[model samples]
Every structure is written in structure tokens, then in C-alpha cells.
Target: MTSPYAQQGFRVGFDWGPAGAAAVPGSIVAVVDVLSFTTAVTVAVDLGIDVYPYRWRDETAVAYAEQLDAVLAVGRSQEGITLSPASIRQAQGVRRLVLPSPNGSTISQQLSDSGSTVLAVSLRNTSAAADWVAARLTADPSLTVVAIAAGERWTDGSLRPAVEDLWGAGAFVAGLADRGVGPLSPEARAAAAAYREVAGELPEVLHECAGGRELAAYGFAGDVVVAAEVDISGLVPVLQGSRLSESSKPSRFCPVT
Candidate 1:
């Protein structure tokens, strides 16, 4: 029997974190973490860098980066090329980077073994990611897609359901709907509706949201601005094996209006 939690009847689904990802398995899975992870990925991919998602920023991450000949991103306060999108944007001479996060990156690494074609989605690249998924769906009628919002963790180490990720996932969901790729699950529809409600005021809302405010307090306000540049990116970062690189498929979809 198909698990009801899998949202089996829908062509598109939405859920939160690693558990949600496990519940709603799809041929294509998009992991969204708007405050940082996915946003940083978009920026890095935009600069022609390959991003390898890691679960922790410890010595293990250093060894993994060495194994792949990549630079390991440090904490925001510690040095060069942190997880902040602005840091990735300003970085140069980096062909590959290992970025670790407890939320998005961890979930991404967990899903790497699920046999799903994983894509990194953020406000900056929703259109491109959606278009890529939609094109694949058109080619394969059996294909299903799931958008996972990698919400932050609470102090006690529980999901905090970050609003920024909701919007980011919703933006990708809405993009798929706009491209006529629907029959969406209720969770997916709700996310799309939420995105539509705040489409016009994304920058302001992101700046004011808890995650955004926290980053701003840490002096990373510019990262929030970069993350809020909805539809500005044309590159789709697709996971191949353990690293995410630009999709080789040529995009034929219309730009977001």
C-alpha cells in the first residue's frame, strides 16, 4: 500500500525537513533554505562553482573537501567564503566548495542516496529550477516532484518552520503551477498560495522575518537582499552524485514576468 504520507496521487508535493523528505519521495526533489544554504548555492553556481553539501563544518568536512579538491566554507564570523550568499558571491578562484548546514545541507546529503534528482531551490533560482523540473515532467509523464523546505532548528534541536523557506518552496511550487505542471498536493497548494500572497513584498517580508532578522542582527543583511532577488537567476543547480552543478539541459521556458 502506498503510504498516505507520501502524497502518492499528486504530481507535486511540499513538506518540511528530512522527515518530510522521507515521507514524500519523488523523482525530482527540491531542497529549499532561503536564508542561506540554497541561496548560497545559487550564487556559487552562478559563478561557475560546484557546491558539495556537507552535514557538518568540522574536521570531517575538511577531509571531505580535500577529497574533492574543494574549499570548505567556514562559519560566518570565522573567515573566507562562509555559508552567507554574499560571501559566496564575493569569492573568487574557487572551483568547488563544501558548504555545511544543519538544515538544508544536511537534508540534501541525506537525500543524495534516495535516487531522486535533487535540485537546490531558493528565491533567486525558482524559475529556473521549476522550468527544469517541468520540462522533465513533460518528457516523463510518470515523474513526480517534491519541494522540501529546510526549516531552521530550534534551540532544543527541533524544526522551527522558517517562513523564508516556506516562501522559497512556494515560489518554486507556484512556478511549476504557472508552467502547467500541476495536480498539486494540498500542502503544495498551500505553499503556492502563501507565495502568491507575498510575491510583491518579498524583500520587505524577508528582511522582517525571524530568520532574516537574525541574519541582519549578525550583520548579514546583504545576504537577505541577495536571497530575495526572486527570478533573477537563470542557472539551475542540479545534484549529480554528491555535488551540485549547473544542469546541462538547455532551458526553453519563458522568463518569470
Candidate 2:
């Protein structure tokens, strides 16, 4: 008999936050934060900058940046080194950046410490990230992956499922499917289905989603647009320690609903 725990239910699975990540057992983990963090990291890595995930923009982050000799991102709209994808893409003379976010960064930090292979994924690099992971799985056939969507929180502190992230992660799962990776778990199958449903309408869907409209109302709609772009980037960020760097065509990306 297959023990319930032994089944693990998901070899390629999708879940929301750190708790969700913990619930899904996998040798590799992918963290998705499409509206921001992961989007910003993808942009920064494409520009050849290393990124560090910090949970807060506080003194601890400042000190950590100093320790890593990295630039700390300010507000998403601030003048210099902010979390804006545009800023990170345009900034020069910086080799490293520490980006802080409540959702993505927290999950990245948690996964990094969990000792699993960690990859950061966003809409910008979905295909690349998934392909990277798939190649590894094909090579070994013993590794499992879990894509965790770093879902946003409500103002009153509740889990707010962001559609953009679902799309990002879904695209990842779909990419793995395209590579003929597995009999995907139910959660992974649903995520891939979600991606196929919205693949052609990604930009409009993101623009109209709650998070997209919220950012647009705050005058950050360009960020949403950037986050919606699929596979324009070739960068795949792999988390090693607390910092994220381009994984040299040997890394990964994935999931949520």
C-alpha cells in the first residue's frame, strides 16, 4: 500500500505561502511574486545585477546590504534604487541589490533556509525558469519541484490570492508539462490549465486584476505590464544563501491557485 505521507500528493505542485511551501515536499522550490519582487529580480538579473531577498526595508536589511556590499531598494516610486522594475533596469554601476518585500522576499528567505534548491520566477522569465528545472529533472529523474506563489496579504492581514502570480506559476507548470516531465499532481495540473486559459490574454488579464488595478491606481501600472510579459527575458535567478543570481543556464522557476 502507498502510504499517504509517502505519496506526497505532488511531485510538481503549487501552493501559496511559506506554510503552503512547507506542506508540499519537493527537492526544489520555486517562488513566484509577479506583481513585484520576483519581477524586479528578473529585471535586475537581466541587467546583470545580483539580488538579495530581504523581508523588510528596515535596519536589518540595511545592515545586510552593507554586509553584502549591495544596494538596498527603496520605495517602488522613489528616485534611486527603488523596487520598480524600470529603475532596476535603468540603474547602472550597481552589481548587487537587496530587494525587500513582505510576500516574495519572505518566502524566498524561508525557502533558502529550508535547504531545498530555490529558484525565483516571474512572468518575464517563466519559460526559461521552467526549462531550466525540467532539464535538471530529466537528467536525474529523482528530483521533485514545488512552485510556491507568494500571495499578497490584505490590508487587515489575510491571504489575498493574486491572479498575476497564479498566471506566472501556471505558466511555469505548463512549461514543465511541455517538456514531458511527469504525471503531474492535481495541483500542478490545475495551474497549467489556468495558464493555458489565460496565455493569450495575459496582459489584459493582469491589467484588470485587482492587484494590477491597485498598482495602476497608485501610478505603477507599468510595473504590472512588465510583470505580464512572458519569456522576453533569458535570466533565471537561483537563490544561493540570501542572495539571488543568474544561474547560468543551469537553474529553474513555478506554482499557485
Q: Pick the candidate with the highest lDDT.
A: 1
Give the alpha carbon lDDT tens digit for every residue of 80-146 in model 2. Answer: 9887787777798998788899999888887776778899899999899888999898888779898
> Which portions of model 1 show Cα errors greater than 4 Å?
249-257
Colliding residue pairs in candidate 1: none
At residue 191, candidate 2 shows an lDDT of: 79
lDDT of 1 by residue, 1-257 (tens): 88889988899999999999999999999999998999999999999888889999989888888777789999999879999988887898998899999999999999988999999999999998988999999999999999999999999998999999999999999999999997999999999999999999979999999999999999999999999898899998988778888998333222111
Kindly give the stretch of ten consecutive residues in candidate 2 with the minimal lDDT sum: 248-257
Off by over 4 Å in 2: 1-9, 249-257
- What TM-score, computed on C-alpha atoms, does each candidate reach? 0.95, 0.92
TM value for model 1? 0.95
Query: Using TM-score as the measure, which candidate wins?
Result: 1
